[model samples]
Each structure stands twice: as C-alpha cells, then as structure tokens.
Target: MSKVVLITGGSSGIGKSVGEFLTQKDFIVYGTSRNPENYKNSKFSILQLDVKKNDTIKKAVNAIIASEGKLDVLINNAGAGITGPIEEIPESEIKANFDTNFFGPINVIKAVLPQMRKQQSGLIINITSIAGYMGLPYRGVYSASKGALELLTEAFRMELKGFNVSMTNVAPGDFATNIAAGRYHAPLIDDSPYIKPYGDTLKLMDKHVDSGSNPKLMAETIYKIINAKNPKGHYKVGEFMQKFSIVLKRILPDKIYEKLLMNHYKL
Candidate 1:
C-alpha cells in the first residue's frame, strides 16, 4: 500500500513542491492550506487547515484518516515569518508568529499522535529554518519561533520512540518562495532608532531569498529522508555557507560568533 503523506502549507512554496514530488513518487499525498478552494488545480488534494486553529487541525486530520485510513507521514511545514527590530515589533505580532510557527505545529502533532501510535509506525518531519539556529538581526522573533520548534522536535523524538512514531526536523535556508511576501513586517518607522540598520538588513534578507536555492532541492531532500530506514534527529538543507554557519556558531566563542554575524549583516 502507498504511504499517505500530509504536508501543511502545501498550496505553494516548499510544501507544494514536496507534495507534488511525493505524488509523482506514488505516495498518497495531501496538502493543507488555510483556503483550500483556491488550489483546485494542485497535483495532490488540498485540505482546509489553519495551524493556529486547533479545531481546523482536528478536522483536517480526521478527514485525512477517513479517506486514507492512516497518515504515514506528516510534514509540519505551515509557518509564518516576522521581521523587525526586536524593540519595534509589537508584542502581539511576536505572539502571533509563535502561534503559527511553534504552537501550531505542536497542536497538529497532538492531533495526529493517536492515529500514528495506533498504527505502530509513522513519521513526522518538521520544516524548520536555518535562521532558527541563531538570532539574526531584524529577524529575532522568526528565529525564536523556529528555534523552539527545533528543540520541540528533539524532545518529541524521544517521547515518540516507544510508540514507533519517528520525528525529525529539517531546517532549510533561503529558498525562492512566497514566504517573504507573506511574512509580517513591522512598519519601518521614520523616527525609529532602528530604521537604517533594520531597513538595510531587510533588503539583504529579501535579496538572499530571491537568489536562494530552488524549492525542488527541499523536495528531493524530504524524499530522501522518508526513504531512510533511520532518519536522523535533524537535517539542514541550504547553501554550504548557511549549513556551515551552524558549525561556526558551535566552535566559535559567543562574542566572536556574535561579532561575525554583526560583520556579515554590516551592522
């Protein structure tokens, strides 16, 4: 029997790429979008699911189970990005980002665990970000939210082990996607102290995304992980420098790492 895979935020970007790839590979793929009606032409089925809303998560999971009997894999790819000076960003916006990036994935996992536990075999792959590995200028909130999810996956792997449900985190660097357009940006206040530095950093971030790797790279990586008999606890997919940055953080002193980041961002 073909494995039934569920990918959140699958209407476009990395999730859509992964869903389409898996479908081509003969997997029963289902992708979730807040507004499913808009994606009528998707290669895989698009279900209605808003990660921030627990009710919708349950309904989507139940609908998938009803149709497919079991969900063999879950790609927790639904996430929202936020960028601004930490001081300038509203508290509400910070919480909202966490709701989608951190709490949202947790809730979806909670809803799927029972079914996965019952099956005695399942895999859950979380789509985290390379930014999550460190605190970047103007993107602090986004970093914290995704970082929290990365840690959550580490803990979840151990908890789910006895139940035969595997969990892992796949952190991707800048990919050419609509995420930059969809992400929330605190207004660039003309009078704010962070205007110049924040503005410059924001432009650099967008440029990186515009020139980033293809989303298909992420799709291929996801496919490889799914086929692996024993997927590692975490995987990073991105430019050599992006992946190496994580290593540099570990080896370099805190102050030195911070300095390197500051120099890189031209801050």
Candidate 2:
C-alpha cells in the first residue's frame, strides 16, 4: 500500500509543495489548514487544523486515521515566524511564537504517536530552520523556537526507537515563500536604540527569502527521507553555505563564530 502522509500548515510554502509532490508520487496526502475551505483546489485533501489548537490537532489526526486505517508519515510543517530584537519583543508575542512553532508540533506528534506505535512503524519529520542552528541577530525568537524543536527531535528519536517509530529534523534555510508576509515583526520604533540595525537586518532577511531556493527543493528532500530505511536524526537542506554554517558552528571558536555572524548581519 502507498504510504499515507499528513502535512500540517499545508496551505502554502514548503508544506504545500511537499503535499503536491507526494500526491504526484502516488502517496495518499492530506494537508491541514486552519481554513481548509480556502484550499479546495489543492492537489491533495486539505483538513481543518490549527497547530496551536490541541483540539484541532486531535481532530485532524483522528480523521486521517479513521479514513486511512493508518498514517505512515507526518510532516510537522505548521509554524509561524517572528522577527525582532529579543529584548524588544513582547512577552506575549514570544510565547505565542513558541506555541505555534514549538508546542504545536509536539502536540501533533503526541496525537500521532499512539497510532504509530500500534503499527510498529512510522516516520515523523519535523521541518526546522537553518537559522535554528544558530541564533541570528534580529531573528532570535524564531531561531530559538526552531532550535528547541531540533533538540526535541533528538530526544524523541531515542524515545521512539523502541516503538519502531522514527523521527527526524529537516532544517531548511531561507526559501522563497510567503513566510515574510506572515511573520510577526516588532515595530521599528524611531527612538529605539536598535532601530537602524534591526531595520537593516530585517530588510536583508526579506531579501534572502525573496531570492531563496525553490520550495520544490525541500519537497524532493522530504521525499527522499521518507523512503529511507532509517532516516538520520537530522538533515539540513539549503545552499552550501547555509548548511556549512552548521558545521562551522561545530568547529569554530565561540567568539570567532559569533564575529562571523555579526559580520554577516552587519550588526
């Protein structure tokens, strides 16, 4: 039987791209959107789900299990982006980002694990970010949230090993997507000390996304991981330098790496 897949936040961006590609490859794909009605023309079915809402997560997962008898894979792709100096961002905004990017994925995973454990086979792929590998200047909160997911995946892989359920993190760099439009940007206050620096970094970040790699690249990468007999705990997909930065972090002196990041962001 073709593997059944559920992709969260599948209305657009990497999630939509992955869902469409998997559908073409003959996999049973169900994509989730808060407003499923908006994506009636999607190549795959779009289920109503809001990652931040546990009720919706359970509803969507249960619906898939009820229909398919099994859910072979889950792409935890539902996430929001936030950008601003950490100090200036509101406490509520920070918690909200974590709720969506971090806790949301965890709840979805919780909903799927029992079914996956019963089957004794399943793959859970968490879509993380290259920025998660290292804290970027103005993108601190976004980085922290994704980075936390990365670590959570590491721990989950070990815990799920006995159940034959596999989990992994696929961290992608800037990808040309609608993410910028959706991201929460702390207002640029004219009198704030970070005004010029934060504003410049924000523009550069937007430029990177505008010129980023095609989301199709991420889709192809996800497909490969899904087919693997045993996917690794983590996979980084992006331009060479973006992936290499992770390696640099591993080998470089702390201060030196920090300097490189500061230089790159022109902070």
Candidate 3:
C-alpha cells in the first residue's frame, strides 16, 4: 500500500511543493487549505480545511480516512507571519497570529492523534520558521508564536513516543513565499507611536524574505524527512544569512547581538 500524507497550507508555497514531491514518491497526498480551489493539481487530493476551525479539521480528517484508511504523515504547514513591535501590536492581532501559527497546529495534532495512535506509527511534521530559534526585531509576535510551537513539539515528541507517533519541527530560515502578504494586515494604531522603528526592521526582513531560499528546496527537504525511516526531530533549512543569523546568535555575546540588530535596523 502507498503511504498516505496530509499537508496543511498545501495550496501553495512549500506545502504545495511538498505535496508534489511526495506524490512522485508514490504517497497518496491529501493537501488541505482554506481555499482548496486555489490550488488544483493532479498530484494530490485538495481538501478544504481552515486550521482555525474544528469542524473543518474534522471534516478533512474524515474524508481522508474514508479514502486512505490510514494517515502516515501529517504536515502542519498552515501559518501566517505578523510583524511590528510588541507594544504596538493589538491584542487581537497577536492572538490571531498565535491561533494560526501555534494553536492551530496544536489543534491539528489533537484531531489527528487518535488516528495516529490507532495505527501506532505516524509522523507529525511542523513547519516552524528560523524565528523559532532566534528572536528578531519587529517580529516579536511571530517569533514568540514559533517559540511556543518549538516547546510544544519537543514536549509532545517525548509524550507521543509511547504511542509510536513522532513529531518533527522543520525550522526554515527564510523562504521565498507570500507570507509577507499577511503581515500587511497587522493592526496599526497611531497612539502606539512605535511604527517608525518597527517599520524599518520589518521592511528589512521583508526584503530578505523576497530573495531568500527557494520554497522548492525546502519542500524537497521536507519530502526527504517524511520518507526517511529515522527523521531528526528538528530540521534546519536556511540559506546564507539565515544560517549566519543562527550562528551569530550562538557565538555573539548578548550585548553584541543586540547592538548588531539595532545597527542593522538603525533602531
């Protein structure tokens, strides 16, 4: 029997690439998205799923199970990027970021655990970001969301071991995707007055994201991990600057790193 893999946010970007790659490997791919129609291809089954909605999640799972009988892999790749200083960000926007980035994946894990446990073997792959490892200016909320996900991934990996369900966190540094489109929706308040500095840092990050690692490469890495018999718990896929950023965070002093970040953004 071919392996069955389900990917969230599979309509585009890395999710779509992963779906295509896995399909070539003979896995029956069920890719979920809020607007499945936006990405219709012969490689995978496109299903409607809004990670934030429980009813949608249940429906997607039932549909896939009815057809595949078992799910071998689950990729929680649906997430958004929110930018701006912590103080300036509205409470609702912050909550929404967490809902999509961290909590939504948590919900998916919960919804899929029963089926995974019943099978006694399944892989849960989370598409975290380089922000998961290092804190960055103007990305406080986004970084925090990924950090929460990292903690959850580590804890859940150990907890799920007894059930033979494994979790892997794919933390990519920077990727060429439309994630920035979501950042524009961040709430703006004139009273906060932190926009100037926040905007400078965010602009720099956005520029880099536009020219960063190819989503296809990240997708291929994801496909490799999913098919591996023993996949690492964390896979770091980042290009030059992203990799350097992580290295700097490790080698540089806290004061030095702070100064560097401030200078880079002219904060």
Candidate 4:
C-alpha cells in the first residue's frame, strides 16, 4: 500500500498544489477544506475540516485513522493571513489570528500524534512563512503567529526524536498563491495614523506577492522532504534572494537589517 498523507487547507492555494503533487506521486492523499463540496478534484480524497475548531480537527483525524488505519505524513498547511497596521488590529482579531495560524495546527498535530506514535515513524511538515523570522511592519500579528509556530516546530523536533517522528518547518518566502483573497484586514480607525505609511508598504508587499516564487516549486520541495530518509529541521523556499536575506539576517547588524526591510517596504 502507498503511504497515507493528510494535508489541511487543501481546497486552494499551496495546500491544493501540494495535495495534487502528492496524489500524482501515488500517495494516498487526504486533503482538508472547510467546505469539501467546493473542491472537484477526484485525484485525492477531500475531507471536511476547519482548523479553527478542535472538535472538527478531531473528527477529521479520527475519520482518516478509521479509514486508512495508519497515517504516514501530515502537512499542516492550513493558515490565515492577517494584514494591516499592528495598532489597528483588534485584540479579538489577534486572538483569531493565533487560533487559526498557530493553535489550529497545534490541535491537528495533537490529534495525529497518537496514531503516528503507534506507527513509530511519521513526518509532520508545518508550513510557516518568511515573515515568521523578521516581523513584517504591517502584518505583525501574522508574523508573530508564524514565528511562534517555527519555535514550536523546533522544540517538537527534539521531543519527537525518541518516537522517530520528524518535524520540519518550511518557511516559505513570497509564493504565488491567492492568499490575499482570504486575508483579513484590520479595521483602520478614522484618521488612522498608519494610513499613508501602511498604504505604501502594503503596495510593495502586494507587488512582491504577485511576482513571488512558484507554488509548484514549494510542492516539489515538499515532495523531496517527504521522500528523504532523514529530513532536516527547517527548509526555506523561494528565490536566491529570499534565502540570501535569511543568511544576511544571521550575519548583518541589527540596524542594517532593519534598514534593508525599511528600504524594501519603503517605510
């Protein structure tokens, strides 16, 4: 039997791309979506899931286990993109952001662990973001959420080593996806202080996203990671520039790095 893989938020965007890639590669793929009816792809099973709700996550995982008897890999790809000025974002919005982007994956990971533990070997791939490393100017909450997940991935990697379960955090830079379509915009108040600066920075961010790296490349990277004998801790996907920026962040002065971000965002 082929390896069984489950991916969350697989109705569209990078999740869908990865699911299709895995399915084509002959993995028994189960992709999740809030509304499975929206997906018409017969290549892989479309399971109903809402990462925001723990009960829904439990249900999805239970169903997968019941059907497959074993799960070989889990791709925590479901996430929400929250954008706008930090000051303008409400506390509720911030909580919601973490609930979906951070704890959502947590809930799913917890659900799958028991099954993977019994199997004694499994792989968990958390789809983080480049913004996770360097906090973005306008999307502070989103950055914080992913940053938190990156740390979780690192800590879990060490903890899961005993069970032979591997954890890899994929911090992808700008990738071509329709993430903006579902992105939440913080409510800007009347006479907002961040209006002009945010407008300029967000416009630049949009341009970069529009011309970002291919999602197919991300799928390919994930495919390789899933097939490897011993996957590494973290993988950063994007162009050479994106990888270089990560390298620069390590060696460059803090002030210089901030300046680079400022120049890039024109803030």
Candidate 5:
C-alpha cells in the first residue's frame, strides 16, 4: 500500500517541490493551496485549504482522511512572512502572522493526531526558519511565530514518544522562494512614522534573500530526513551561516549575538 502524505501550502516553493518529490517516491500526496484550482500538478492532487480558516482546514482534512483512510505524513509548510519592525506593526497583522505560522500548524496537528495514534505510526514535519533560532530586526514577529513552532515541535516530540510518531523541524536559512514576495508590508509605510528608523533593516533582510540558497536543496534535504529511520529533532539547511547561527547562539553571550544581528541588519 502506498503511504499517504498531506502538505499544506503545497502550491509553490518548498512545499510544491517536496510534494512532487514525495509523489515520485510513490507516496499518495494531497497538497493544499488557498486557490488550488488555479494550480495544477501531475505529481500530486491539490486541494483548497486556508490554514487560517477553520472551516477550510476541517473540510480539507476530512476529505483527505475519507479518501486515504489514514495520513502517514503531515507537513505543515504553509506560512506567510510579515516584514517591518514589530513595534509599529499593527495588531491585526501580528495576529495574522501568528495565526498562519503558529496556530495553523497546531490545528492541522490536532486534526491529524487521532488518526496517527490509532494507526500507531506517522511523521510530522514543520518547515520552520532559521529565524526561529535567532531574531533579527524587522523580522521580529516572523521570528516569534516560528519560535513558538520550534517549542511545539520539542514538546510534541517528547509527548508523542509512546505513540510511535515522529516530529521534525526544518530550520532552513534564506531560500529562493516567494515567501519574501508574499510578505505583508504595512500599508503606507512611506507615510508611517517609523519608516525612516527601520528602513535600512528591511532593505538588509531583502538583500540577503535575493542571494539566498536554492529551494531545491531544501527539497532534497527534506527527502533525506523524511526517509531516515531515525531523524534528528531538528535539521538545519541553507548556507553555512545558518549552522554558524546555531553555534553562535550556544557559545556567544546574548549581547554579542545581539550585536552580530544588529550589525548584519545594518542597524
């Protein structure tokens, strides 16, 4: 029997690539997109799903469960980016960011756990970011959302031990993806009061992404981790700087890491 995989935000970028790769490996993949009708892929079936909408999430899950009998893998790859300083970012934007990046995955996890528990086998992979490990200017809220997910991965891993389930968090650095293009910028930033003070920080982050690593690399890495019999708790992908970030976070003092980030952001 072919294993079943469900991927959120599977219409493009890493999610799309992962979905295709998994399909080639013989997994019956159901990939979700908000406007799934607009996208088509021969490798996997696309379903409409808006992670932030409860009705959509419920419907998508139910349809998949009904069709597949059980889900063998759940990939929470749906996420949006919110750029600009956290202080001036509107409350609604902050909530929206958290809703998609954090709560969205939580809802999927909740919906899938019961089926996985009954089967006594499943894997959950979360596409978090290096931002989850280290904070940067203008990306505070994005970092916080992923950071919350990082913790959830840890907690759920320990708690789900007896259930024969596994959790993996992929913290890749900047990748060639639409995440930056999809980032929600506040309206009238030119008219906003905080624009001048933080304008440089936004530019710096955008520049890094423009020269980021290839998304295919991330897809390949995900495949390796997914197939591994005993995957690590977290896998770091991207440029070596991402690996350096983890080491720096561990060995360097807070002030030093803060200075490093500030310098990189040109703040």
Candidate 6:
C-alpha cells in the first residue's frame, strides 16, 4: 500500500511543490489551504484548513485518518511572516505571526500524534527557516516563531522515539516564493521614527527573496528526507551564504555574529 501523506499550506510555493513531488512518487497525498477553493486548479485534492483553528485542523486530520486508517507522513510547511522593528510592531500582529507559524503546526501535530503513536510509525517534517537559527534584522518575530518550531521539533523527537515516529526540521533560507508579497509589514505612518530604516530593510529582504533559490529544490530535499532510512534532526537548504550562516552562527562569537548579520542586511 502507498504511504499516506498530508501537507499544510499547499496552495502555493514549497508546500504545493512538495505535494506535487510526493504525488508523482505515488504517495496518497493531500494538501491543505485556508481557502481550498482557490486550489481548484491544483491536481491534488485540497482540504480546507486553518492551522490557527483547531476545529478545522481536527476535521481535516480526522477525514484523512478515517479514509486511510492511518497517516504516514505530515509536512508542517505552513508559516506566516512579519517584518519591522519589534517596538513598532503591534502585539496583535506579533501574536498573529506566532499563531500561524508556531501554534498552527502545533494543533495539527497534537491531532495527528495519537494515530501515529498507535501505529508506532510515522514521519513529521517541519519546514523552518535559516532566520530561526538567528534573529533577522527586520523579520525578528518571524524568526522567533520558526525558532520555536525548531526547538519544539527537537524536544518532540526525543519524546516520540519510544514510539516509531521520527521528526525532521528543514530550514530553507530565502526561497523564491510569494511569501514576501503577503508578509505583514509594520505600518509606516508619516511621523514614524523607523520609516527610512524599515524601507531599506524591506528592500534588502525583497532582494534576497527575489534572488533566492527555487522552491523545487526544497521539494527535492523533502523527498530525500522522506526516503532516507535515518535522516538527521535538522537540514539547511538555500544558497551558500544561507547554509553557511547556520554553521557560522554556532561557531562565531556573539559580537562578531551580530555584526555579520547587520552587515549582511545593510543595517
């Protein structure tokens, strides 16, 4: 029997590409979107899901479990982004960011674990980001959210080891996607103090994204992770600098690392 797979945020970008990749490999694949109807053009079936809403998440997971008897793989690729100075960002926006990026995957994870635990076999792949390794200049909240997920994945791996479930966190840096277009940017009033800096930072962020690696590369990485008998706890995907940043962050001193990030972002 083919493995059953569920992917979140499959309407576009890495999720969509990964969903298609898994489908091509003959997995029983299902993708989720907030407005699944928008995904009508997609070849795979789309489930209406909002990671922030437990009812929607439970319903979606239940529907899959009922049909397949079990879920083999879950790709927690759903995330939201926000950019601006921490002081300037409203509490509501920051909470919204965490809700979609952190708590959202949580609901799905909690709902799916029971079924996976009973079977004593399953794989959970979380699509984190390089920023999660270190806070970015403007996208600090987004980084925090991804950082939380990465740490959560680490802890869960130890807990799930008793069962047969495995966890993998893939951190892709600046992938070419529509994410930047929709990312929440802190409002800039005329009297705002950080307007100039915010504009410059936003430009640099866009430049990195516009020139980022293709989403299909990430899809391929996910496929490799799924097929590997024993994948590592974390995998970094992106350009040389992006991948290097992770290793450098670990080895470099605090001041040097902070300076490096500032220089890179032109801060």
Error of 5 at 124 (Å): 0.4
When 1 and 4 are scored with TM-score, the better candidate is 1
Q: Write the per-residue lDDT of candidate 6 for residues 1-267, one digit (tens) a residue.
A: 999999999889899999998889899999999999877889788999999999999999999999989999999988887999899999999999999999998889999999999999999999999999998887899999999999999999999999999998999998889999889988776788878888888998898899889899998999999899988999999999888988898899999999998887677
What is the Å distance of residue 84 in model 6 from its true position? 0.7
Using TM-score as the yardstick, the better of models 1 and 6 is 1
Model 4 C-alpha lDDT per residue in residues 24-80, reported as the tens digit of each score: 999999999999987775468899999988888999999989998999999999999
How many clashes does each candidate structure show, in the order listed? 0, 0, 0, 0, 0, 0
All candidates: TM-score: 0.99, 0.99, 0.93, 0.97, 0.95, 0.98
Per-residue lDDT for 210 in model 3? 94
Residue pairs in candidate 5 whose N, alpha carbon or C atoms collide under 3 angstroms:
none
Candidate 4 — what's its lDDT?
0.90
The CA lDDT at 184 in model 1 is 99
Better of 1 and 5 by TM-score: 1
**Which stretches of candidate 3 lie above 4 Å from their native place?**
184-192
Worst 10 residues of 5 by lDDT: 185-194
Which is the winner by TM-score between candidate 3 and candidate 5?
5
Better of 2 and 4 by TM-score: 2
Candidate order (lDDT): 2, 1, 6, 4, 5, 3
lDDT of 3 by residue, 1-60 (tens): 898998998888788888888888888999988887776654788999998899999899
* lDDT, residue 8, model 3: 94
Local accuracy of candidate 2 as per-residue lDDT tens digits, 4-32 = 99999998999999999999999999999
Candidate 6, which segments miss by more than 4 Å at Cα?
A: none
Please say which candidate is ahead in TM-score: 4 or 5. Answer: 4
The residue-by-residue lDDT of candidate 1 on 1-267, one tens digit each, is 999999999999999999999999999999999999999999999999999899999999999999989999999999998999999898999999999999999999999999999999999999999999999989999999999999999999998899999999999999999899999999999999999999999999999999999999999999999999999999999999999999999999999999999999999
